[model samples]
Structure formats: C-alpha cells, structure tokens
Target: MNERDLKKLKSKKKGKERRAAQKAERARLAAAQLLVNQANAQTDPLSKFPSFINYERNGLTSSLICKKVKELEPELLQWAMNLCKENMRPLYEKSNQGWHEDEKVEEMTEDAAWYLIVLDKAANKPLAFSHFRFDMDYGDEVLYCYELQLEESCRRKGLGRFMMQVLELMAFSNQMQKVVLTVFKHNPDGMNFFKKCRYDIDETSPVDSYEETFDYCILSKMNKMKPTQKTSL
Candidate 1:
C-alpha cells in the first residue's frame, strides 16, 4: 500500500479506538448512576410510596383492642387509657348526652368498641377515639368502622373528613372489603360530609333515639393503600 494510504488507515484506527473508549465510559457512568438510584430506592421507599395513616374512627374500638393487649404492657395501656378517658366520655356527651354510655359506668360498657385516629404527628393531641363495631354484611364478611363522635370543641373544623380518610386507609390495610358508618338523619351536616366522601346508604335502622335509626352508609375504596411506614423494597 502507498505511504499516504497507510497513514490514513492509522488515523482511522485511532479515531475508532477513541470512539470505543468514549462509548465504554458513557456506559460505565450510566450503570453507576443506575446503581445509586436503586440503592436509594431500597433505603427509602417513601419516595415512591403513598403517605398513609391507619386509625380507627371511634373511641370504643381502641378500648377493645387495648383490653386484648392489656397483658402486653402497662405503658401502652396507660397511654391508651389516657387517650380514651380524655376523649371518650366528654366527646360522646358532646355528640348527644345519651349517644354513649354514662362516663361513670363506661368501663362496664364492654360491649362498646373504640377506634382511634392520630392526627398529625406534630399536633398537640394525637387522634385517638373509639366507636361501636357493627356487623354490616358487605355481602361477604361483616364490615367494621368507627361511628365518629363529633366533639364540641373540635367540631366543624373539617376533622370528620380527615378522620374518615385515616380510617379508610386503616380498613384497607386490614384487608377490610369496605367501611360502613352511620349518621343520624337529624345530622344534616354530618350526612352532607359523608355524601361528599361518596358514601351511600346501605341500610336503615329500626328507629330509636340514642341507638336511633339513621340511614346507614357504605363508603368503599380500592383498598389499595400501602402505608409508607410498612412499605418494603
């Protein structure tokens, strides 16, 4: 081959080598970035997860749960009891004097169930409450929900909506098919709130004042929530 042709061939080979080196370096950098991203994801699933909280709607549900766990530890019971006692009777009376058991004899109300909702972690008070557990047939297993007690102090501040959302997530995480709750027909504002949440009446009561008849509502969600705290890689 001519000297000129040989020189051209050497130049071409050098260019190809440089191109190959650049391509390999780019691949290495990309792979490194991918590893970093994957590692971060493994450590913090919350970045890709939904923030959810689990809470019971009523105060009585917690009492039952606490009672069952009474043998576990005293600290839990003390904290739970405080939350229940503080919000239990007064809150119930706020709803209606007869809506709940007399505070004095409430301990005897073993039949009453309680649910709890912990408000924002930063809030001065944690959302803890209780409710009765009704066996409403969701066409399959009986559904349970907190019949939230509307408090006089905290009422009308949009807490009901917040509590319901928290309860829904808890129910979903527990494999509950749906959540069922009741509002007195006289509670128009309460009924409106449930309607806004798209709750529908599933059953009506037989009619009594305290345990009175009201349109029962069933609010169903996809049960698709996976709390961020419990998420895994």
Candidate 2:
C-alpha cells in the first residue's frame, strides 16, 4: 500500500483497539457494581460465616453480630456512638477536622451503614464495634471500614485483630475489590495496627503538598484472590 493509505489503515486499527479497551472496562465496572449491589442487599453479611461470630481467645470472649443501621436497636446504636466517641473523640479533636458530633452521628445513622458489633459474652455488653459499608470508592468496589472503635478495657487484646480479619473475610467473599479505611496520621497506634494487619496506603490516599498537608491517610488491603490491574505511577 502507498504511504498515505498505510497511515490511514494504522489510524483505523488504533481507533478500533481503543474502543475495544473502553468497552471491556465498562463491562468490568458493571460487574463490580452488580457485586456491590448484591452485598448491600444482604440483611446479615456475617450470617454466612458462622465461625466468625464468636471470639474466644486472648482472655477476651466476645460474640459478633452484623446488622444494618436500621436493624440495630436504639440502645445498641447509642452504645456504639458512645464507644466511638470514647475511643476517638480525642483523636478527632486533635485532627485538622476537629470533632463534629452532629456530623458523626448523621454518618453513623445513615441508611446504608452497617455495624459489626462485638459484645462481651459474660456481661452482655458491647466491647467494640466497627461501622462499615459496601460501596464504590475511586471507581472500584470496596468494603469501607468507617470506624473500628473498642472500649478501653478491650484495648491491647487480640480482639481488634480478630475483628479486622472478619472484615477482610466478608469483603473478599462478597467479591469486593478491597477493604479500605482512613486512619489519622497523629494516631501512631492506629496506623501501626493497620500496618500490622497488612494494610498499605491506597492509591487514592491524599499526598502532602507544599501548601497543605493532610492529617489523615487512606489505607487498604487488596483481595489477593481477585487481583485487579493497578495503574502505573
């Protein structure tokens, strides 16, 4: 073929390849959306994992239950809120955002929010709780852990790690892309805890700039069983 004809052919082939890639991406994201929707519809994501319901080690015995915000009793919700404030208010007040009780309550009571609550079996009182949601983040389906607060008495025990493992199991079993959370930079203990659990700074986490630095960072643990393509930096 002549030079001009060859150039035209090459352009046409490139255009076709680009369109094909775009179509494939759309299909992939559609599948992700479907997975998230299915997960959100479940009344109890934890029900399927019977073994994870009970924590009976590290000298701390507790039972876990997962429920949507609407399903939670008023008193239980109040306790969770109180525990969150007890564990995090100081850290929140110290952060750039400061502590906003109203905003936090609103978020905790959102219709889509879910709670994985841990109760002390003997006393029948809550020891820890994690508020989370299955949603899309940065174009990927993720299990976003909003809060993982434990009562002071439960700290330093292995309950925190066990709860994290449960969250990971639920996230991956339901086909979520990953388990994501935000941790304050000032809370070294919190940051170190997640790091020990194998979480790393996610791609979407904000970076410090010369003008303004962030006080918090986003961390995530990707599902090794269902790997996704990562964009090159």
Candidate 3:
C-alpha cells in the first residue's frame, strides 16, 4: 500500500478501537448504576440477613438496625450525628481540612445516606453508627462507608468489626464492586482496624505528590465473587 494509504488505515483502526472502548465503558457504568439503584430501593438492606440483626460478642450485646436517613427518628439521627462529631472532630481538626460542623451535619442528613446503628438493648441508647451509601463511584457500584463511629464506652468491643462485616455482606450480596471507606492518616487505630478486616488501599486512593499531600486515604475490600473493577482505560 502507498505510505499515505497505510497511515489512513492505521488512523481508522485506532478510531475504531477507541470507539469500542468507549462503548464498553458505557455498558459497564450502566450495569453498575442499575445495581446501585436496586440496592437503594430496599427499605432495609439488613433485613435479608436476619442473623446479623444482633451483635453478641466480646461481652457486648447490642441490637443492630439499618435505616435510611429519612426513616430514622429525629432523636436517633441527632444522636448519630453527635457520635460522629465526637469521634471524628478531633481527627478532622488535626488534619488540614479541620472540622466543619455545619458541613458534617449536611452530609449526615443527605437523602442518600444510610445508617447502621448499634443500640444498647437494656438502656435503649445508641452506642455506635455507620453512615454509608450505595452509589456509583469511578464507574463501579460501591457501598461507600462515610463514617463509623462508636461511643467511648463501646470502642474496644468487637462491634465495629461486626458492623464492617455487615457492610461487606450487603455490598457483595447486592453485587457491588466493593465496600469502600476513607480513613484519616492520623487515625492509626482506624487504619489498623481496616487492615485487620483485610481492606487494602484502593486504586482510587490519592498519592502524595511534591506539590500536595492528602490527609485521608481511601480503602476498599472487593467482592471476591466478581472480577475486580478496572481502574483505567
């Protein structure tokens, strides 16, 4: 073939390949969005796992309830917000972002927010809570755990880990690509706990550069039943 003809052929082949990749990405994202929608439609994701409703380990007995932010009682939602502030404000203040109470309140009350709350059965008080969402992140359906907070009295018990397990179960069962969370760099205990749960630094986690560094890191545990999500084209 002539030189110009060969160049044109090559260009056409590249364009075709690019178009094919774009089409495939669109399909993948559509599937992920469908899964996220189905998950969010549930009144209570925890209802599917009856055994997970109660946590009776490490000498702590608590009842677990999963509810959307809108379904939660005003007092309960307030308690969850207070616990989150109490646990996270110090870490946020220590980091570059500092602490913003108004912003935190807004996030906690968002319509998409879901809560997994642990209640002390006898005293009928909330002891711990996790705020999460079923949403598409980076083209994959993910259960993003925004906050996991426990009262000072309940920190050492196995409740936190059990809550994480519940999140994982719900995510994988609903065909989510992963259970994702962000932990502050300054919180060594949070880092260690996630590590113990077998979570790794997710591909989406930011890397430190000479010009800028991030105070928080994203961690994720993938659903082993499915192929891992592609991070790049």
Candidate 4:
C-alpha cells in the first residue's frame, strides 16, 4: 500500500481502538451499577421518612427525606437528634463531650452543618447505624467535622471506612481543599482510624473555642485536582 493509504488504515485502526476502550469503560460502569441496584433490591428499604434519607453512598441507598430537611418542623428534627444522641452518646460522653442533642440538630440547619444518617441495607431491619456531621469546606481551604459515630453493633464491618470515602469524595466535589476534624486524644481507636485515612495529628488549640483536654487535629489531604472540561456529578 502507498504511504497515504497505510496512514489512512492506521488512523482507522486507532479509531476502532478508541471506540473499543470507550465501550469497555461503559460496560464496567454498567456492571458496577447493576451490582449496587441488586444489593439495594435485596435489602429492605427505609420507611419513606422525610429528612431521614438522602445523600446515600453508591452501593448504599436511602429514601428521599433529605430533600425536605430544610422544611422539617420540630418533630423530624427531634427524631434525628434522638437518633444521634442514642447512637453517638457513648463517643460523646465518654470522650468528654456532649452536644445539645436536641438543639444540635436544629443548629446543624441554622449553622450549615449537614447531619446525615446512613442505614445498613443488608440487615433484617433497616439499621440506622451511621451518623456524621460536616460543615462546608469553603474553597477547599478548611473542613470542620463533628459527630462521627457508628453503632456499636455495626463496628468492625468496614462501614466507617466506606462512609469516610464517600464523605471525602463529596467534600472534594463541593470544592473543598482540605477537611479538618478534632478528636479527643484519649480515644486511641478514633485516633487510629483517622491516622489510617492519612490525616495528620495537629495538637494546636484555638483560644475561646470549646476547651478540650486533648484536641488532636484531623487534617485532610491537600487537593491538587485541576478543573476539567468534563463535569462530574
């Protein structure tokens, strides 16, 4: 074949290769989505409660209550608060802290803290076991986190790590550069968990803040992701 003809043939081959790669990637994503749907289908869905579901992780699912939290009255807020208190009381009191459980839920709304609950889908019941709080990280500069707890029964099941991964991705998606958290030095288990996620232990104390015996800092990875033309959801 002439050089031009050969070049045309090579170009066609490259086009085919690119198409094949794209098809393969799409298939991989489809398979992953199918697995998640299958898992959700197998588990019992939550009781269609308002503000009780939303912001679920992939492979995890929730009802649509999160869409209505802003309009939730005192009753819904009370339930969320109690759930947080019941599930997180151990960590709070044992760790030398007890937030205003009732008022805290309202404060989350008033102060921009998102109080989220994650349910265990694979259980006999829809287990409301995971709860967390995080304020928006303005421009990836800083992150303030609170009330991270997993039910004692749900411990050691990889839920904590899964939730953290989801939260960090969400944080980055929301334009956060760094995520920050503070934990009691006495809680070695908590410290170890943060360490596993590559957070640094900053021991600095801020004056006029809630005085704590030991405030080990939880620092996030410095994000260096440049914006791409392709948008991510």
Candidate 5:
C-alpha cells in the first residue's frame, strides 16, 4: 500500500478506537449515576413515619413495614411491580392495556407515594405490598390507593385487611379527609374486599352511562374526625 493510504487507514482506526472508548466511558458513568440515585432513594428517612404492624392469622404471626416509595430499594420496587402485574393481570387485560406499561416507577418516586410492604423478616423478602398516594383532590386532601397485591400464598391470611388498616391510620395521621380508590367492575373479589373495609361509592363517582361497564368504580371512606368550627358571638 502507498504511505498516504497506510496513514489514512491508521487515522480511521484511531478515530474508531476513540469513539469506542468514549461510548464505554459514558455507559460507565450512566450506570454509576443510576446506582447513586437508587442508594439515595433507599436511604431516605421514610421510617420516620409509622413503620411496624404486627398481626396473627390462623396461628401464624407476621409483621409489616411501611415505607414511602422514595425509601424503597430498587429491587423491592421491582418485586412489587411484578406482584401487581401477576395479581392484576385480569384488570389490565380487561382495560386493554399491557401490565408492563402500567408499571409507573418514575411516578411512584413522587413525594406523596408510599408503600406498605409485608416482609418475611427472616428471609428479608417482600411477601406483599400496597402502593398509595396522598394528594389534593378537588381542594380536599385524600389518600388514593393505586395497587395492593399479595402473593397467592399470602392471601386469605388477613394480610390484606391489616395492610389496609395501616394505610387508613397513615392517611388519618396525615390529616387526609378520606381514602379513595378505584375497583374494576369486573373484579368482584376486589369490590367485596373494599366493601368489607367500609368503602362506599364516592360522591363524585360518575352517574349511569353507556360506558359504565368498561369504567372503574370509585370508592371512598371518610375519616372519623370531625372538622372544628369557630363561632362568633
């Protein structure tokens, strides 16, 4: 080959090597940043809010730890999402949406989102989780439950009711006027569960409509505390 051709070939090789090195470096930095963010999220002081709840069902005792969404380990959050997908597949299929698409990890990181995780203390693994959010609804503070899914083995063990009671306590402590959630009309089990928990059709629920069969039913339970009034003499 001519000297000029050889030199051009070397230049091209060097350019390719440089670009490859830069790409690797960028990937390394991005991975490192992701680790740092996950660490920060997991170490947040969510334990400051109510943490432990203990209960016994059918001769077995269990405990749960409530943590804000920002305080969850990335793996734990992924587990929760997987559980949601497994337990709510019917609802997702009925709604014509992919379960994976409903996994809102980024949105769960918002300040108001929280999770109630039931853990196998010895194994340090999550058995179930409840995801909810505290936010303003029509100028009134409310707690909205997004998902509550338990392992099949954990169901019928009273864990569902226990976690819900804990959620209600958290909402009332935070001064939420009521707790609200939506249930799929086709999910009779879910509807019965919420009804047993004393949740009734919310006042703002939609009236009769042609599309009601495809719509979710909104339910709510008001806090027992009454608002204080000031009187002028």
Candidate 6:
C-alpha cells in the first residue's frame, strides 16, 4: 500500500481501540453503580433507633444514627477502631505516635464521645463511622467531628458525601450553629474533600498557636436555620 493509505489505515485502527476502551470504562462504572444500588435496597429498618436517618444514593442505602461510643457493641466499637487505624495510621505516624497499638477504647467511650455510624443494611455491616460531640467552640455550640473514617472498600463511592450530608442535617436538627472538623495537613485528600463539601477554614482555629504544633486544618460549615423556628432537641 502507498504510505498515505497505510497511514490512514493505522489512524482508523487507533480510533477503534480508543473507542473500545472508553466503552469498557463506561460499562465498568455502570456495573459498580448497580451493585451499590442493590446493596442499598437490602438495608433493614432500624426500629430500635427511630430517629435514625435513612439515605439512599447511587442505588446503595445507608442508615445514619448517633450513639454514645460506650453504647456501641464491643465488636462494633472494635470495627470502628480498626477503621480509624486504617485511615489515620499515616497521620499518626507523621506525628510520631503508634496509633495502631494505642487502642484508646476507654477514651473513645467517654460520656461526650458520640459516634455517627453508617450501616449497610443488606450486608449488616458498618460502612463508615464518625466520632463527634457537641462542644463550645469560640462561644458557639458546634458539632465537633473528631474522626470520619470509611471502610477502604467504601472510599470512592458517594458514601462519604452522603454521610456528611446526614451529619449536617443532624447538626441543624439539634440547633447546632455549625459543624466543625479537623483534617491532618498530611492528608491532602481529606482536606480537599471537606473543601469540596463547602467547609472552610475556621477563623477560630489555632492555626498559628505556639503551644499546639500539630499539622492540622480545622474546617467549619455554618448551619442554615429559620429565625422563628427552634429545634425540639
């Protein structure tokens, strides 16, 4: 074949391959989304915790509820600890601490240590958990989130965003002025995720304090409330 014809044939082949790859990627994503939805549909009702909020996204369903860390079952608390170790090991290591070995279960069970757990009903498993409490921050009542960790398998799904949305709703329902959380500076992805969710650096953060030298970013999102309405809680 002439050089011109040969070149045209090669270009056509490349175009076909590129299209095939794109098609396969789309198919893979669609399948993943389907599995998530099926899992969500299988969630069981939380009759014990009538106040639990049920949310559905990407065909997956998760239940968000609050409980004192002490109230959690031993196995569930252990699951949470394992998740924290998996997600925060790098941050802890950066600060020269052995977080994995320090179970800290007693500290986690403090009266003020509350947990927000997202359970996958169909699989009867916890998909993610957040440790938080209502505390006075700069003279304002804010929900302070200590840890928000998801199972490794659940990371890329919309579960993080879904959990945060539920948390914010809970904050508003409880008359919290804002929701606040701290992210390690070493975890740029965590920082970026909070920012994308509309959380901004809190002016009250001790970013420049001399005594507190840990590399952390404190983020806050103000709650929207009606002037005349008050939360029953």
Best by TM-score: 3
TM-score of candidate 3 on Cα atoms, chains taken together? 0.96
Model 5 bad stretches (over 4 Å): 1-52, 96-103, 109-111, 211-214, 227-233
Give per-residue lDDT, candidate 2, residue 212: 81
> What is the C-alpha local distance difference test score of candidate 4?
0.49
lDDT of 4 by residue, 90-199 (tens): 66666544555656556545633443445444542233322323332321233345656655565655556655655555445444444567666657887788788777
lDDT of 3 at 111: 99
For model 3, the superposed segments whose C-alpha errors exceed 4 Å read 229-232
Whole-model Cα lDDT of every candidate shown, in order: 0.45, 0.92, 0.92, 0.49, 0.70, 0.70
Model 5 lDDT, residue 55, Cα: 57
lDDT, candidate 1, 122-169, per-residue tens: 343434443423232422222355445443455555566765665564
- Output the TM-score of candidate 2: 0.94
lDDT of 3: 0.92
lDDT per residue as tens, model 3, 31-119: 88999999999999999999999988777778999999999999999998888887888999999989999999999999999999999
Ten contiguous residues minimizing lDDT sum, candidate 5: 36-45
The local distance difference test score of model 6 is 0.70
Instruction: Candidate 6: give its CA RMSD in angstroms.
Output: 20.3
lDDT of 2 by residue, 60-115 (tens): 88899999999999999999999888889999999989999999999999998999
TM-score of each: 0.42, 0.94, 0.96, 0.51, 0.70, 0.67
Model 6 — which ten-residue stretch has the worst lDDT? 39-48
